[model samples]
Target chain A: MPQRIGQYTVATPSRPALLSYAAAVGNKEGDGPLGSCFDYIAEDTTMGRGSWEQAESMLQKTAVQIALKKIDLAARQIDLIFAGDLLNQCIGSTFGLRDFGIPLIGLFGACSTMALSLLNAALAVDAGAARYAVAVTSSHFCSAERQFRQPLDYGGQRPPTAQWTVTGAGACVVGHGEGIAVEALTPGRVVDLGIKDANNMGAAMAPAAADTILRFLKDTGTEPGDYDRIFTGDLGVIGSRLLCELLDKEGIDLRAVHRDCGVMIFDRERQDVHAGGSGCGCSASVLCAHILPEMAAGRLKNVLFCATGALMSPTSSQQGESIPGIAHLVHLRA
Target chain B: MKPTKKEYDAMTNKASPPSPKGKNSVFAFLIGGAVCALGQALLEGYRAWGADLETAKTLVSVTFIGLTVLLTALHLYDKYAKIAGAGSLVPITGFANAMASPAIEFKTEGPVTGVGVKMFTVAGPVLVFGISASMVYGLILWVIGLFD
Candidate 1:
């Protein structure tokens, strides 16, 4: 059995950080907007399949700059890169970092991009793959929404279970640390709910979240009450309720402090956030902006972040349409 | 000698009169429009095929019911519900369309668990209320027949 770091071992080597690189590439207000930022990740209607690559690179550049500012380290000093996003070829973030010349390895896990990136970066440090490893993931809300279903201009009113996408980028650096260290890896497994209805993503995603969390608990031998907080990526209101209900049925009650980023982003009354926001960027932005700060502040010790994502393709959805959701878990010990 | 005058008078006084405020104005208008539009469309469409008035109305209602069932099964009506919004809820199609949405949602675990049983998901609740209300109405009419 892997040595689960005993109590009080984490001192937090990485500072709670925010990088300075950000560009709102889509059409929207520059201020704190209620909804997501990117109106379109990439214009697939106009830019062919190649456009996804361009959007991905842009995300990567933004991530690298922000990460660099947090560490006062130059791009040349960084040795390894673990970048991810919802798009293919890791286009948005990867292409953007190409000019920086870091040895970039691309990853994809929908909204769980950061968690996936973190697991890889942490492994690189743990296994001595490199001296310094950077983890990056980005999401463009508009691009995802348009690609998944219909164009916003088409006047599509999303269901109460539907979620809004976040248009933002986030990155983290997992280097050799004497400070707070990567504690555990609760490897995520794909649990197919077999839900064919694209309209009802809540039902599709809830069971997957339950399955991954249950597996993580079983494998790590961590009790449900072991951690103070357990977070899920984008299981907004509908998915969250179902997750609670399903897990309760399995006799695994999670934290009273359990929360989802999708439900937290907007004031539901003011923004009319329907079900909530779900996307790769939703989890990434929240983890970087909110959860990291708390971790740095020593406000939270053990956080099991499981970012949920739907893996169905547009072609798949169009043909008798089914949405197969997957969730990935990352255990960050502070 | 069944009851004293004062006792009978007290019982009658205890019964409160029903409020005369009209039912939901918006709901009434929407439902009325939906029923009339569906009824008219069916009659006109069938009249082209030389059907009588009564037969055309029945044909139209049946046609509407059939389309509703197909859309309900394929889950196409739920898609239309997104675009149509409030308008979709106005018609009989809305009720029928909502039938399989819940069933399809629960159907992922397994067929016997999700499909065979869940096929009655929303419809079960709806039919229960519908039958119960109609039974009450029928009972009132039956009691009135004795008086006649």
Candidate 2:
């Protein structure tokens, strides 16, 4: 299975600067973590204001479009499409792809959806499910807010824990037989920490991600120090420390390279990126844009991306409980 | 010993199993079930209203938020939640009620962590389920693809 890193792009409902500002504001309370977190190739400014459903569709389409432009493959030529976004219906993905005429699969790993989608695409190619696949997911703060929190225009200052939704979308296409490929991967196993609070997704998701990354490294006969970088979807500042601490508890110390997409998106204090976690777009943009380009430029070699997500439910919460969380990994090699 | 406000807010979700009185449990159940029936009708009616699915969900959320807030103000949300159980849940309004109920109970936890965090507790489950389910789905696809 040739996992061609053919193309990647990011779509955000927030302007880059606003995202920057939000991140800075959020980070003032804490020391930040991670690298060029929210950087990506293309951006879509034309936004739709409706429910999360409507906004997600526009954002998803924007990302897929940019990725397609780079690959220049017709919709029919594409073997399959794998996508995810932070919407209830996977709206950004499904509706955006409604007219594309390709077999569609919608996924939602929250902030980890980008990696989750990419992992699926890689498997599709490696397992001979398809020749070429499109994978993308978007995060719209407005839509997310409208759907989950208050409305878009609802005037409220976000707390330190709240993250700026990258008004950006990211995507990449994996095609069989050539280009910078995803050659070897250690698929991540899911773990639940049973931390049901959604406000602290970083805490909920970190343990799961840490557990899986440890397992993948062990099962594959690989070491954490083997990769040039070990990264997760959105384990912001607080969760990132907890992850490192958790890893240490298991007698695995990753002194080499560990990073987080959430922690990387903005400059701390300057960007208000308190504790460093955003939606799926965080890791998607980093991997698809910064990391992939760095790999293409031969500045980087093998890397690991462990995407994590929290799993909670209204029924569970109303019943007065915490949420469960999980993580998945995709190791990419040059 | 009784719980403090913070402890109460935290433990409210972990309510103990009821210790029934000798004979009135059935009557209480019937009355509770009947009230739940009315709320359900209104919720279903709101659901059936002419609107986009997105709009309808928002309407439902807002309606629930409004109703829950009203109930919280009137000190009824906690009572209803106890009586209705799953009935209080199952609807998006339950999310509204969750936040407001905790706010009422834990107002002493200070404004930020106590009230703010409580606000998200209701919606917290949505994030958790959405994330976990998707990751599982992603894993399933990965495993299935290996077989293919």
Candidate 3:
């Protein structure tokens, strides 16, 4: 069983080695700063699918296939798969990974799904429940727009605070073997700082990220300087700044080590991605493609990867419900 | 930690990107006028081709919708709409965009469920109410004419 540290923190006694991972991105995301790190940059966003949702499903399928191939593990070898996406009922994951023939636990942590899936997979492996497990999540710009916001052709004007949903998929294979082992995990509470604006996701999610980070630090009895880097999920520029401010208020300075996947994924000044890149794919693809390689190369030793999420549906937003945010923390050590 | 006023001010003062603006009506006016001018030009062109006034009017409306859908597919209309603001919502083009945008966005769901279903999400309500109101008005007119 996974050891419970304090509150929501879990210490996985049996370390799980991340065997291999793969990422696939759409054309726009392929042009971002970490573009080349992705395993596949699909020329067609549709991936030969007739619809955007189907394309997203295809993206997840391709990412998992590549990840399994990287480790030379056939689909049947994997015991279980954890997958989710920013689609209604998570059809993106369900329809995408159906042929894998692995038992799946579909998850929904909104944009924070990447870390949530990772943490769960690590726990399953740590508990010796599965010999090999796969964790995957995806998001598509077109599909997300169709579901959460106005359709692309509506000619709706995007505000500067709005982030561009990354059109990509990322998958990882975890085993109770040698690799980057997960040190600890912290599940976030649904924090609501009374933010109601859906477009300003960074602001809405920052409090939750800060809340989880503080909880993780206190639970592990560690300091901000203990980790080489503290990576937050798609908090974008505004959210990152806010997180720093929130940490500073608690006397926990993260000036040197703090970095967000949102800021690192895109060149904000050049790319028209307003606040920054966001979505499940944002952190998932970045962590899988760029950060894991850095860990493998022995560049980053101990790192804190905190993925934040906004849990709000269109109906809830219409009902005037404030956006509730959650952040899942995973401690990775090389 | 309960921060003092000075510390709070210092902490929150980090430079970030500009916030969304609330005013852009002038740009909307200018761009909307330009869109309207294009429609007027199409109307005159059809008239010059010896089409009747009613036929020319219908052709102008159809041309505006067709051009809007084409620009939307080319991924240029959103940028134009962003700058134009509410100005781009000039009835014909705006309505066409409202219909075409959802259809194109949902096209990935498949033809029957994705496109066929969501295509009417926006336009369906408009068509239902529009045709119903017109029929009601026509019935009233006929009722009054029977007395004459």
Candidate 4:
């Protein structure tokens, strides 16, 4: 049974292990700073698919296959799979994993789907609800652009605060055996700060990220210094800066310990990724490709992985509704 | 103490870097001028080939739209547009791209619902306002003629 801590944090006494993980990314992401960290890089983003949506589905399928292959486990061996993507109806996950024959719980946390799915998988494993659980999430630049912003070939200039959607996918397998331990989890509340600009998602999500991180730290009785790294999912440049500023008001100095997956995934100056890499895959692939690998190598010990998400759609934005943001936290120790 | 929504928004604005407007404007100007110059050259060429003024003008537009559609199909227009910004956007070529991109992208959803419906998504507002404003202008001109 999971123990309830102060406010929203839940302590996983059993500490379910993260058994295996893998990441697959597109050419752009593969050319980035952490390019070598990924298990597979699709030189052709379409993966020879007829459409961008199908290409996105292929990314998810490839990620899950690589993850399961790492531990020599078949898809049937997985008890439950929690998966999601930035596509409408999460067709990326559904179409990709449908043939696997494993039961799946589809989530829709936008970019935070990676962390949200991971936290749920960890909790379920800890409770003995399933012998093995898999968490997976993905995003594609072409697919996301057509759905959220503009057509791929549309000639529009992106603002300085606009983040490039990462064309990648990540998958992780969780079980009770030996691996990185999932220690604690903090589920976030939907925080809306009246941010209406769709381009500035980092700013829109920063408040929720700060709120969740603060709550997690307070509930766990841990300082920023205690964790080797506190990773925020896809906050990019603006959100990362704002998150530090917001935490500073509470007398917590997070500047030194904080790292945003969005910021780390791309070389902003060289890649022309104005703000930084974003979308569900920005955090998902970074975790599987870089962060988890670093932890396994003994370079990192205790870490807080908080993935933030902007819960808004094109319809919602067009209707003049403000974007509501959410962030979920998971504490991992090796 | 937690800051109010207004305060937080202000903080966000303060933290975000401003867009490079001055540099972008220069690029936009150069690119937009180049596109216009190409159109003029094409018009001159058509006229030299013995076409009438109206025929040459129509040929210039047709050639530009056709070339834009081809570049869009080859996935080259967007790359140029990224650097050119408004240079590529505020032209006859831009309108062609606006129509062609969704047609290419949503073709997987089928010819009818996907390409046909989504074809006007981006340019629809521009078309709507353009036609509406022209109607208002025509109405004002009709009123003036009656007074005359």
C-alpha RMSD values across all candidates: 15.2, 18.5, 4.0, 1.1
Q: In every candidate, how many clashes are there? A: 17, 33, 3, 0
Worst 10 residues of 2 chain A by lDDT: A15-24
The Cα error of candidate 3 at residue B121, in Å, is: 2.9
Which candidate has the top score in lDDT? 4
* Candidate 3, lDDT over the whole model: 0.88
Against the true structure, what is each candidate's TM-score?
A: 0.62, 0.60, 0.89, 0.98
Between candidates 1 and 3, the one scoring higher on lDDT is 3
The parts of candidate 3 lying over 4 Å away from their true place are B1-26, B42-58, B107-116, B123-148
Encode model 4's per-residue lDDT on B6-48: one tens digit a residue.
8998898898888899999999999999999999999999999
lDDT of every model, 2 decimals? 0.62, 0.61, 0.88, 0.94
lDDT of 3 at A15: 81
- Per-residue lDDT of B1-148 in model 3, one digit per residue for the tens? 6344354334434424444454567877788888788878888899999999999999999888898899989888888888887888865888898889878877766788988999887778889999999999999999999999
Top candidate (TM-score):
4
Q: Is the docking of candidate 3 incorrect, acceptable, medium or high quality?
A: acceptable
Instruction: List model 3 lDDT by residue over A206-320, tens digit each.
Output: 8889889999999988998998999998999888888888888898998799998888888887988888989999999999998889999999999998988999999999899
RMSD of 1: 15.2
Residue range with the least summed lDDT across 10 consecutive positions in model 4 chain B: B1-10
